[model samples]
Target chain A: GQQVMQIPQYQHVQEGEDFTTYCNSSTTLSNIQWYKQRPGGHPVFLIQLVKSGEVKKQKRLTFQFGEAKKNSSLHITATQTTDVGTYFCAGQLAGGTSYGKLTFGQGTILTVHP
Target chain B: DAGITQSPRYKITETGRQVTLMCHQTWSHSYMFWYRQDLGHGLRLIYYSAAADITDKGEVPDGYVVSRSKTENFPLTLESATRSQTSVYFCASSESGTSNYEQYFGPGTRLTVT
Candidate 1:
């Protein structure tokens, strides 16, 4: 079975501080997707990284994929109050009979205090 | 747009009772998935369907069953509910089952079993 592990199960920071969450997969992934869930809300798609050593940015957030495609990270710069939520990384394994299946990490709960 | 919706946003049941959660998507997406979210367990897949009448198990499919009688409807049933099954259930849909597709999630359904 494939597993995706995320670090810092919970994090709290000042509004202006930076935060980072790491995700590692036990198996190589063909692609990885990031999602965010606000308090009392459903998960929403954020971004996806496919190539090895890939890096993508959206506003204050930066996402990076490891060269081996077995790990990924999300870094938020100068976090805002609106950034408080849970961040999850899901990995799609690279192999047969496992297509369309995504293994999600336990997720990082981020809270920013003003 | 009313992309996806889940019925019975909240539910309460007792042991040995049968329960069903309904999921519908207006996008006519080809892929639909059911996942459960609990404390310390971010989100675990229960079942997924590639199309009408084509369903498969996911990471945490035990004690749960799913059916896709039509392209827009995917229902999940619990034959015999247990306290351990108490969690937030989410239904998601995507245009395709490919690894690159982005999933659209519905407002989750919270079920409490006593």
Candidate 2:
């Protein structure tokens, strides 16, 4: 079975501050995807990282995948009040008959105070 | 301009009752999934379907049943609901059952059992 762990279960920061959430997987992943869920809302896909040591940016947010493909990190620069939500990382196992099933991490809850 | 959708955005029932959560997608995806979200547990997969009449269990499939009679419809049934089943359930669909494809999630259904 595959497992994913996330760090900093909860985070609170002032507006304009930076926030980062880390994710680690028990097994090598063929790909990883990030999702964000706002208060009283459903999870929305953010981005997906496939290549090892890949880095992608979306405006104020940056995502990076470890060279080993076993870990990932999401960093948000200059966080705003609207950025408050829970961030989740899901990993798809590399081998076996997985059929694209995803293992989700516990997630990091971020709260930005303005 | 249609996407995945879930029925009965909110539901409440007593223990030992039977309830069904419906999921519909217009993308005609080959893969569909059901996941439950709790406070600490990010998203635990309950079951998934790979085309019509093909379904498989996921990480947390106990006390739940699923059927995919059509390519665009997948429904989850709780034959005997319990208090522990109180959580938010999300439905997602992917273009194919491959790691390279991204999953699109539905709004989610909140259920509570007394």
Q: Can you give the TM-score per candidate against the true fold?
A: 0.97, 0.97
Predicted candidate 1: what Cα RMSD to the true structure?
1.1
User: How much TM-score does chain B earn in each model?
Assistant: 0.96, 0.96
Candidate 1 chain B: worst 10 consecutive residues by lDDT? B95-104
In candidate 1 the C-alpha lDDT for residue A39 amounts to 91
Error of 2 at A24 (Å): 0.3
Clashes of each: 0, 0
Give each prediction's DockQ, rounded to 2 decimals: 0.78, 0.79
Tell me the tens digit of each residue's lDDT in model 2 across A1-114: 789999989999999999999999998999999999999988888999999999999999999999999999999999999999999999999977776788999999999999
Error of 2 at A49 (Å): 0.7
Runs of candidate 2 exceeding 4 Å displacement: B97-99
**Candidate 1, A5-113: lDDT as tens digits:** 9998999999999999999999999999999999999999999999999999999999999999999999999999999999999998887765366888999999999
Q: Write the per-residue lDDT of candidate 1 for residues B1-111, one digit (tens) a residue.
A: 789999889999999999999999999999899999997899999999888999999989999999999999999999999999999999998877455778889999999
